[model samples]
Target: MAIEIENKDQQHPRAKKDGEVVERLLQESANDNNLAEVARLRIRYGGFPGARSMQRNLDIVLERWNLTEEGLFELTRQIHAEGRAYKRNSNGEEQEDWT
Candidate 1:
């Protein structure tokens, strides 16, 4: 079964809403009818290439609510092998090849 749906960018799926138990908390600013959805989006889309959170979906909720760090590390646990990881520099722009 599919979880949260992805936003227009189609980068990753939403996260705030789980299988229907936990509630989402979005930022007041820019937060309106779509705020809950956006919060869900940040959680879901943020943890791409892997599961929802380090342990489970709840963690994603906590991270987003506190703005502490939701599934942030998951993005760097070497989720992918050399062939899958982005071959870019810290700046995110693709690096040049010399060797």
Candidate 2:
């Protein structure tokens, strides 16, 4: 005899979308040469279930990396641009719009 199990609560569609976004961001972070920024990204979203976790993580990463908030913002901006170029070419818009 065999038993079967199932999840009681399925993830919402928005949660799934959020997970995809996080995965993409992590993938971008993983490719960077900057270890400190990678650590910051992990701390920001690596399944830490705590109150004010993001704030605490930001503080730690900034101090450890000696980076100002603007530096962090710039780092994230570069990371976010890594894979977004494809979106410009294949956004389901009219072909004429791409020319």
Q: How do all models score by TM-score?
A: 0.21, 0.32
Q: Write the per-residue lDDT of candidate 1 for residues 1-42, one digit (tens) a residue.
A: 879966542222322224332443322322222233333444
lDDT by residue (17-84, candidate 2, tens digit) is 43444444444433343433334444444454432334454456456667666676676567556732
Against the unseen true structure, what C-alpha lDDT does each candidate score?
Answer: 0.38, 0.45
TM-score of the candidate numbered 1? Answer: 0.21
Which segments of candidate 1 are over 4 A away from where they belong?
Answer: 1-29, 50-99
The residue pairs that clash in candidate 2, if any, are: none
The residue pairs that clash in candidate 1, if any, are: 14-44, 15-44, 16-40
